[model samples]
Target chain A: MTQSPVVRLQDVTKKIGGRTIIDRISLEVYPGEVFGFLGPNGSGKTTTIRMMVGLMSITSGDILIGGHSIRKEFPQAIRQVGAIVENPELYRYLTGYQNLVHFARMAPGISRSRIDEVVRLVGMESRIHDKVKRYSLGMRQRLGVAQAVLHRPRLLVLDEPTNGLDPAGIRELRDYLRKLAREEGTAVFVSSHLLSEMELMCDRVAILQKGRVVDIRAVRRDSESSEAAPDDVWFDVERPEEALRVLDGLGKGRIEDGRLAVTADRKTVAEINRKLVEAGFSVYGIRVKTKTLEDQFLEVTRGESVG
Target chain B: MADFLRLLQNENMKIYRRVGTWVMYAFIIGIPLVMSLAIISVTPEDPPSNWLFMFIASNILASLIAIFTVVKAADAVAGEFSQGTIKLLLIRPWRRSSILLSKFLAMLLFGLALTAAAFTVTLVVGTAFFGYTASPEDMFSEMGRKNPWGYMLLWYLYQFISAVAVASFAFMMSAAFRSGGLTIGLSIFILLAGGLITNLLSLLDKPIVKYTLFPHLQLTSYLDGGPGPLPQYPMTLGFSLAVLGVHFAVFVAVAWLAFGRRDVA
Candidate 1:
């Protein structure tokens, strides 16, 4: 079976003011998946996203959205992609509804009802009648999101959507975005510096460092036991030499600081313990170390220098 | 076509919503009213010749409207870039040329509307206070019994054309300089300083000074006879039009090329 990605960038490079902002970055976001783009500040996450949506031209590379080449069919590519780069500026004098209506007109075939639907979806229905200048920062962000998704784009790209939001507002935005991707089956590519938010919200994540994709991994679940479970079974044995022999036999274990760390299923740990006991090695204790997303992210992105 | 209309509607909405626009309108009308009242209270007989009155009124109104036009159009593209809204618009399924053209047309319309409003008020007030009658024949007549309908037509066209020329220059400055204030200041400086530079240069009695854009920007002067000691020449009119055309074309070309290649980050 072949699955087409909602958004894809191939060897994208962007140079600005004699510096490479995005350096040969390639990424793919699958349909109906929330792909988190996590990076430090100035890591080219926003630049990459902007190029994907045709907001900024690529210095040297190609971006495809919904099977359309961004350079050749920018409007078609952009038609399927909804994006908010940095702060989403709105017409301050117009009401929230009016702003949505104005943007909606830009998207051909979008009706007034669609505008109302998006306003309600973003939970700005109550305040949609008020002028945008009266809106608080969170309210404006919500309206920005509403304007982005009004045309029901297949791929939604948001750059730091929760930047200035309060805790409550951030939570609300997170929940709203989660529900949006889940219910609408839209592919969401969200770039943020907040790793914890990505861990909580994204189905999968691509960690970027200095315009390079350092790692791509699925979100770990605490309750589900699987082969990919990041729990390292650490065994502290009496004889480090014998432990190494036994761990070598296990084929997936590494000895570090007199302990045998093995990547194995929960049931296999007991077999390894029995083998260590059979080999005349005293096993002091066995502990399962759960790996956090931050650990994985740090491991992937560490030592990468910015271009 | 629909998109163009929508853009025009949005532009009009922006003009109406801005506080600056209203302030400019009030100033345009207010100055003419004050001037009319002052002239009426001071002058006992006919206030002045129609040509003199027109010259004074056109100069004042055009100067004010031109300044406002520079301010408004200077920010047309630059403001969007600063406000971070250009990305949203550019990401839409629209061509860059269309967007730029829409803005240019909107600014042109804005200048024309402002001029019309000021002219209407000034004409009414001047007629009421000065009692200067302007008949169809007077409109057609020129100095030394020369038929100036062609000149007047050229003058009216220049009302929009010169404003467009100023707008184009402002746009170029806007594209080059990201700051709205700097772009506006530079545009106004050029608009006013060009005349000063030309006047200073004319003291040398150089022939090339006639070719400068500043010497012929006065579209109204053509309607009156001509400017300075220079006699009316078909070459002068042609030269002025050509210079302005080139300035306008160069401004737009540079703006488009710079804008098209710019990084919107």
Candidate 2:
């Protein structure tokens, strides 16, 4: 059985100034999963996220967060979400600790201990006492994440959290977010135009183009038996020429520079193994390398006009 | 309610920490000091300085406070949008109206504090230099023998109302315009040019123009007991209060609606 979704949108549409920003897009985000929203600039990724969090009103259809309609019960629905859209803004004049304290007040039942805990969680305990104006860009981004999760929200929505970070900062953020999902069981919905970054961070991805979701795919998960199998499989072998001979007549196969590439299913792999053994060819390795999410996303969303 | 109060506290901290707050306080203190020096330099043979002049001059300085307060309030909301802070704010699981109200209340408190400082300084300096030994009754007699205490209270209240009116207008413009300069510039223009526009309209003999908020921006008109530049109309005080009230209500309503529906990308 499928897991229940923490956030669900059905045929949602958004129009601004007589132009459609998002058009009849449907998506579901399950619990404790990092759902990457991938798109190019002006592809309505931000608009869709805003609709899910009730920041932007939906022109048609409905959005439900944990079984609550966002339009009818926005306060309740939005209460479960914590988002940092675009740039993270704090009171520039106030110290980092003071900024957190101020935002903590707005969060119901957020104690002082929790504020300190979030500061520590983001690795900002040392500089949290310093004014935000004095903070570096990386430090500010950490503080932004600290503020977003202060309420222990079920769903954390971030738009391009790594936009301006250095490579080290990006790696730190990626690891921290993974730990958050693994330990805290919080679902993440992140939007970014960087395809490779999404591939590293997301368990599943939804590709949006021209105000519509073009495709949704689960990364690192085997395909279901009911669905069509993947069309391509890559294998690294010791004897590429020998493996190619064994894989012949098992549909189109090629041996390219010690790698055996085949377009076949799992059963075909078993047959290839049996044939290789009979032919006295040692198959050192046979692994089906999955397609990179970037290739799939680009293939799906190419040549689309976006707002 | 607790959440609302927390938001208000956050807004208070934001405004209080700004350099602008200190600048406003300095202006409040500077106004009375300049007036004291001016009064002291004059010959005693000229009309002796009295509490009435002190009151009128202090009230006029309050107008500057009102303008400063309005500029601050305008930036309170619009600046958030331009700086990309609105996104962080909207995702906080609170209603948009609550945030707006918290900022409004903070600005109001700041305005009142500035006005009170100016009033207190003028009173102390006027009392020390002029040696006007007069109770509330004597002060009222000096101002054409009117109800001095009542008029003083009314004047302060009117100043508060005018400040709030200006704040609301600035906030409305801030919501409509993304740039902070545009919001503050338009608000100042409206406040400074309202009288001039009304005067021009009067030359055209448009009786209905008198009812607008322009002619009533002067809080001291209540102390004067009669209209000076504009013709006296029935329920003059009520009409002035009503005009300010309507202006405030309309601006706040528009701000809330516009902000609630805005697409914050």
Candidate 3:
């Protein structure tokens, strides 16, 4: 928590033609983590990402990248950031390698070997010589990542990066992004409407609705158990009634489909598991029924249509 | 400064790497040859003088060159928007003004290259058909200037200036609009009809006609040692260039304003 953030949005707002497209929203993305902006279509996810990367100007507030204000110091702030605003719209007339070379010339200190290294990292070396017009959407996406990372930016931002990828390609991108954050310590910021994808890819997520940050929280429970509130935990045990009795006064416990489900924090669940095991009961497994972002969204929107 | 050159390299790569761009260049080289060959077949025994042929061929080639460069200039920025690559192009470390300047400079370079190619082809074809009977010392051109070579060079220079002015106008249109087709069509329409508009507007004889862009679009008209394209107007090459300069400055200003401040979305 003490680490300085790589990107910070402080009450950033955007007004386009007298309409507030992005309201005042504040958040920070620290290094060595994957932050997500989760919202539905037209909920200002792309607007926020555009402001973060300087594609759109902020109206009322400021965004800082690597301690440089994006408004006052654009070239310096953008120097530390690499971003794909919506889709990876590259030059389709040029070959993939030419595209990489084109982007490499925009920033300083990107050698030919660095371009090759990024191509290999994205697994695009085989088709990197082909013209981008002949490439499939997934291939273009990989080349897009290669160009974005060629400069070795401190912050990498991808807005809805999984739009056209198949299942396997999406999984590969998720793994690569996590590795990018872990090994290189690059702060990866992604914006997506797909909750399952964000669940798998991001370490922390900020839920935006109507251009406002509704909630921001850590996604992984293990590394952030201190902030874990009470969630539904389903316990698999040998006894049906004894497990219920063990969790009698702790919280509301119910046996659902031959399994004991309790609404309790992680600590209470661990205590209940230990108590059931000590009372001559075999605890087979403990599953924390992590609430999906979709469920939270549904709760927040009150069953309204998200799309 | 070196980094700015690298940015220009990126712009040049985008400009020249396309198949269509090479096709345009081929047309620039081919048009004069085809015209010369047709002229030879039409008048086999009685070919025109070298200077006459050069003027005829250059008039046609130069107009074609202007149109070609204008088309390219129209695509300079609007093509990026059509292909959705402007987002990527603008997100780099450079400022928006620098990006627009690099693109405009590349278009100017393109205009200059096509002008040079057309000049070389016209001279070669003109000399191939008719011998260089008149030396550089001979009295030359419709104006009968003593230095024929200097007169021809000045004519082409004026032609190049006009083409660049029109092309820069197209560049401005490209930056301000999102549709490549509209930019190209509108620019060519104005170019092909500019002569007619200038003639019609000169009848007014008002002082404003001297200031309008149409009166100055045909800079090569001054090569005959005339005061202006419209003899009644009493305009000089210096005066015509000043008018064109004002127009060019306005186009560049509008392009920078539109490209610099607009949101990429």
lDDT of 1 by residue, B1-265 (tens): 9877886776667667778789999998888778766776788565664434554676688878888988888878888877777877777776777777777778888888887786667666666665654342334345412433344335556665677787788988887675788999888887788778777877777777766667666655555545432343334556677888887889889988877766677
Tens digits of per-residue lDDT for model 3 on A102-133?
A: 99999999999988899899998789999999
Highest-lDDT candidate: 3
> Which candidate has the top score in DockQ?
3
- For every model in order, the fraction of real contacts preserved is 0.52, 0.73, 0.83
Output the worst ten-in-a-row residue range by lDDT, candidate 2 chain A. Answer: A221-230
Candidate 2 C-alpha lDDT tens digits along B1-265: 7668878888888887888888878887787777777766785555344566567566668779878888887888888887777777776667788788888788888888877777677767777766654553334434534555555556677777777788788888887675689888888897888778877877887678756777777655666665533764433677777777887789888988877777776
Full-model lDDT, candidate 1? 0.77
iRMSD in angstroms, per model: 1.6, 1.6, 0.8
Candidate 2's displacement at residue A290, Å, is 5.1
Interface RMSD of 2: 1.6
Query: Which candidate, 1 or 3, has the higher DockQ?
Result: 3
Best by TM-score: 3
The regions of model 2 sitting more than 4 angstroms off are A1-3, A221-251, A254-260, A263-290, A303-307, B41-53, B135-141, B144-151, B232-235
Clashing pairs in 2: none
| DockQ, computed on Cα atoms, for candidate 1 | 0.49
